[model samples]
Target chain A: MDFVQLKKNCKKDASAFPGYRLALLGDCATQHLAMALKGAAYEEGIALSVFDADYNQLDAQTLDPSSELYEGKPQGVVLCLCTEKLYEAFTLSSDRAGFADATFRKIKGYWDRINAHLSVSILQFTFVERDDRVFGNYALKEETSFYYQVKKLNLLIAEGTRLVKNVYPVDVDSLERRLGRDKFSDPKLYAIAKMPFSLEALPLVAFETVGIVKALMGRFKKCVVLDLDNTLWGGVIGDDGMEGIQIGELGTGHAFTELQRWLKELKNRGIILCVCSKNNENTAKEPFEKHPEMILRLDDISLFVANWHDKASNIRYIQKTINIGMDSIVFLDDNPFERNLVKQTVEGITVPDLPEDPADYLPYLQSLNLFETTSYSENDRDRTKQYQAEIGRILLEQSFESFDDYLKGLDMVAEAKSFDPFHYPRIAQLTQRSNQFNLRTVRYTEAEIEKIAGDERYLTLYFTLKDKFGDHGLISVVILEKRERELFVHEWLMSCRVLKRGMEEFIVNKMIETAKEYGYASVVGEYIKTPKNAMVETIYAKLGFTDRGDHTFVADCATFQPNKTFIKE
Target chain B: MERNEILEKLNEIFRDVFDDDSITVTEETTSSDIEDWDSLTHITLISEVEDEFDIKFAMKEVVGMKNVGEMVDIIEREA
Candidate 1:
């Protein structure tokens, strides 16, 4: 999008969409950046209200407790430290050898002070790489050169931000590298006004920033729904046979191989991969099973649906089986007809316009950054196996005559315990990513999760499930705030991968048991409606709680009977 | 390019940047005559004009251009 179009988006009505409060602090002029951010967010169906701080007020706003930033009560803060200002500071510094370390310390101090005052996510922009060309090629050898220092500072920001739980480093340096420095920055504009980014680059920078904000708001892609034909490989599997499909080191085949490698890495990082094809199941399975050139195998896919059905309906079925929101699924297809059909039929699905050349596929998709996430843990790597196990349970249920007998045959086991430090990452991840099974849909960061675990008034429970198939690690999270006579369910969310199992029944039983043991009179639960959370609209009623006219439900602990489940807790 | 032609193009750009279709700029028009044409919009307006005429306004021209007539002179000379 251009500057004019984005500026026009600022006037569009965004009241119906979800709103987010953000404070923007920068060392340079930020008025245009704020406008671009709000305008870009509007296109994504988000009403972003930006509190644009004055120029060069990063220290003042963060250091002072009574600053306007604190008064605005923003949920997130965006810090933009431009390369121009950093270069000036570097040139003026007396100790050039220690510049990077000193700069990083000051940046970390800002994060420490702001976090001490307010528990909000910080979107820290990495410095755009600039060189004075003072040492030319030898700049790489000289540690004191601005080029070397800036590169070192970027690395410091990346490693240091990871140590802070809530600071997310937005890689503006990488963006500049991709767009080329000439297009990304206009020196004349910088000289005229303190604007670090050119008018053309503001929209893109705003886009990347808003992507993180959206992910923080629990709106991010969870699964990639892929096509099998010309999209994944070179030719049709049904016609080309396993040997004829191009997906190896020969010519354009390497492109498909690279794309597959990227997709496999994403799958390893916990994004579920699924197959939806129009060819017969055997035809699609032949390449994945027997083709030596294929980078993606049957083991990588969580769900495979290869039938001659319309891709839109097939994607919906895949979504239902996987139990993720339609918005969280990104459908990739080379055929424009199929892409248009899915885009028009599905309400919130993301279907990118795949380029005609297969060689351009991976780069174009990477540029879109479809799968932006806020948290990751070791448990994420096991997500594919968990979903694969869910498919196994589903198939086993079909062979059984009765539902209860099928659940019993699985020999399910579960554990519900208070939140511990070891399981905090996975627990917090569920609260942010879970949508369909989420009650109240309250997203929390790891820092907030740690805070809640330590507070005495809040009771936290994390649930894990395992069966003969595999283990679902830390699948559910519950936070209950203690009232004088009752325990109010502050937050409750469960992974959809464990939906059909008796996990909810087991968890509800544990909640009531815990309440009675703590000498509480009653347990109360609530369901707040979101567009993607309709699956749990009547969860409080279904779990046998008294509807209290409001969106809340209550059960007297003394009179409550425990829910029966096949799982042995 | 003709002087009148440059003025016509500048009028279109001024309408677009100011987000006011009723805006019309002649040789005598200046920043004070426009309600929303402040320092920020002036930058946007100059950028828009530069892109429209396929030219780059020097830093001096960006800040020192006094009126619509002066902007038209730069466009005519650059285009």
Candidate 2:
């Protein structure tokens, strides 16, 4: 749905949407963009409250320390500017190339000022050039052409964002290609209302811009569950056999090749892949093992559940194994019956209606934009391997009679201490995305983590566990605030993959160790109950802390001792 | 459809858009007459009218609208 429909839905039932605050800064009239954004945000479960400055108030809003933009205290900020206005500014001086340098300086200054003062995620747009023939195609080479200048500015903006902490460039160039520039702009509107973009394109811009906002707010998918047979390939695997299955660069099968290749790319980028198909295990595994043309291999799949069982139950098992929210999974099946069944049974899983033809699958999937992430690190490349190792560990646990015996046999070593540059992004990500085992459920941005890393009054610890199977990369974080005469546990978050493996016991033991070493009288912890965090609700009491009402618990530091554990510090 | 017929349909849309069943708009009525008719909500009203009447409105037409009658007149012309 576009902005108009979303706005109408929100207006019909405003209470259904959760409130999010945003500051809008623009060179031209931005009332339409602000309205469209709120509607789009509300559609994405963010009932947006906007703090938009008047036209041409970008300087006043960012530079003035006491401006309303600062006082409003928005969580996300958006800046929208077009080349028409920039071109107008350039014409004031015969030295046109100077405009490019001047504009860059102004933008970089705004970036610096915004960074210094606000702790908000800034979402800014790159210019989509107006196809004016100031120098025709030679505008491509001319440094003075507004088109080339905007292109250079966009590149600089992207490079600067890569280095700068919290700034993100929303590529309007890509969006303009998607919706043609002629369709996206209106000359009459630009002339009268100073609105460069057309009414129809406002929703498109709002939707893309809000994607960044949603990523900042920790509302995005993590896994994509797929169906084999007609879904992945053009033919059924069980009936068609390995050779009979339509695949490779021939026939209608090439579509399946395209789909498989895309899915593999998503897996490599840290999106977990799983199979929920009704087929014989050998038949399903046959293609990946024997077929030379298949793009996806066994190693790329984190979990494969190809069986006679209903897909909904298989999806539940996958969720239990992954320990992520149902909202974080997108299920794809060619069969409408299967899709509807899973949709009804699974509360929050996204099940898009697949087109009748297989050719449309890739384009339809692309439009959903299922996998959204804030940062990419080296750790992401081996995510499928890590999850596969986790599954191996789970299977090994089934063999041992006692869970403790399984823990002891694994030979686990945990590295726990204050944060460093290497673990900073994952550490911040854990705070943002982790829900079930998160104590207090406080989400932190990378900027806030940088602050926490250096603050003396707080103890910021990151934990990484590696055992016989593989390395569980940087799994847990604990932030302890030093109280007057005690050390209060400000936050304790853990990756659920490492849960029930004596890691929690080691973390708590370490907290008490710090309290005793620092000569603090007591160590306190709190468990805030969220719908998803019930598993860790009574965690403090289980660890032998005296329960105080209102989700608070405390223990004497002097009396605390290490629990039995296989982990070596 | 006649203007009165369109008004009947538009009133249904107004109630749905505003989330208030009691809301009844007339030719003389403007955005100020309704409690929820702000700049943000103006788009929702326009969208609902367009959908119900199966028409489109220009940016200038939407922004330049003075009252319910002007909106109805534009929709009728387009229809």
Candidate 3:
């Protein structure tokens, strides 16, 4: 999205957009950045309100809590403090190392000030090196060189933000390096308008900022649903019959093998992989099951929906089976018609325009950056097994006469434990990403988790469920806020990956048990309604709690009994 | 292409870039004339015109061109 176009789109009445106030704080000319971002936000389908600070007023706006930024109360704040200004100060001052340390302190001070005042997330740009060959290549070797100083400064900013709550760095120097200094900076334009970056680099900056914004909004592709045939390999599975399809480390097959390798690695990172192919079910299974060089096996796929049905319906089936929103999926098919059809039918399913040549597929997908995320943990690796086990649990349900019988047969063991640092990363991730099974959705960072765990007023319970088939690692979290003799369920959320295993009943039993252990009379559960979590809307009522309206339910420990489950702690 | 023909093409490109179908360009037209035409859009406009006309803009032409007429002159001369 270009600035002129954004300026035009900004003219449109944005009253209908779910408005998000974004505070853009900077020292140099950033009106264009703000304007360009408005257009970029429009492109990302985000309704943005840009609250930009005045010329060279970075310190004033951040340091002073009474500034317009705080008054506006924006959802996100982007700091674009110009490092070029440091050159003037550095050139005049003799204490180079001291200057660097002071600059680092000042930058961190701004971050601390923002953290002090607001609960909003910060997007800060790290310093880009301004080349001064006065020290030559030796300048890079010495700490006093502007080159070495900038590197140290950027490193300090990065290291400081690591594991710190809510602060994220956007590397402007990396962008400058990638685009090359000449392309990234137009001296003529900078002299004319005080615009630090050239107009060409504006779109890149805008998109990166928007990407982070979208991820924060919990609106990014969660799964990459793939299509078989010419997409995954060099020929049709129906025609090639597993033997003839080209997919190996050799010859023309190298490209397809490379594609499969990328997909497999993505699956390892917990991006759910589902297959929607038009080939016969058996034919589709043959490649995954029998092909010697196939990188993705049947086990790698969460759901394989292969039929003569339209691609869109298969995609819908995958969504229904996995129980994730359409926006969270990216469907890849080499055929343009199928891609377009799926894109049209399912409003938000990301269908990338694949190139005619299979070699170009990986590069194109990389450019899309379809699966950007804020954090990851060891528990992410267990995601594939968790989803795959859901299919098993669903299949086993058919043989059992009752839901209770299904639960009894699974030998489900629920390991009730408190929030441990080892499991805290995954615990925090669940609070952020688990939308469907979430009730009273309250997102938290690791720091907040630590505080909540240590607080006497709060009881944090995490559960890891293991059935006869596999272990669901840390799938459920319950936060109870103690109120005198009573307890309030602050957050109640479980992973859909562990659904239909009588986990809800088991969780309630544990909550009631915990309440009794803590000498509380009754424990209340909240069922806050979000569009994605309707599946769990009646959970509290179903578990024998009285619905007191407004999504609140209460149950007394006197009447509660531990629900029978094959799962044991 | 005649200057009028070049202008017509430029107007179409403008409409596409701005996502407004009602846009038209004349010799006196400047970035200020269109609500969406600013520094960001100016680069986009120049790139699109370059793509459409199969030519590259000199840095001088990119910054120096003031209106649709000057753009047409450069495009015509280059083409």
Which prediction has the highest DockQ against the true structure?
A: 1
Q: Estimate every model's Cα lDDT from 0 to 1.
A: 0.91, 0.84, 0.83
User: Using lDDT as the measure, which candidate wins?
Assistant: 1
Q: In lDDT terms, how accurate is model 2?
A: 0.84
TM-score of each model, in listed order? 0.80, 0.73, 0.72
The TM-scores, chain A only, for the candidates as listed are 0.77, 0.75, 0.75
Candidate 2: where is the Cα deviation over 4 Å?
A: A9-18, A404-468, A471-569, B1-79
By TM-score, highest first, what's the ranking? 1, 2, 3
Which candidate has the top score in TM-score? 1
Those runs of model 3 whose alpha carbons end farther than 4 Å from true positions after fitting are A86-90, A97-101, A129-142, A177-180, A286-292, A398-405, A408-465, A472-569, B1-79
- What does candidate 2's lDDT look like per residue over A120-198, in tens digits? 8888788885646888999998888877777777787888788887888888777888889866776656766678776
Q: In candidate 3 chain A, where is summed lDDT lowest over 10 consecutive residues?
A: A185-194
Which model is ahead, 1 or 3, in terms of TM-score?
A: 1
Q: If both were scored by lDDT, which would come out higher, candidate 1 or candidate 3? A: 1
**What is candidate 3's local distance difference test score?**
0.83
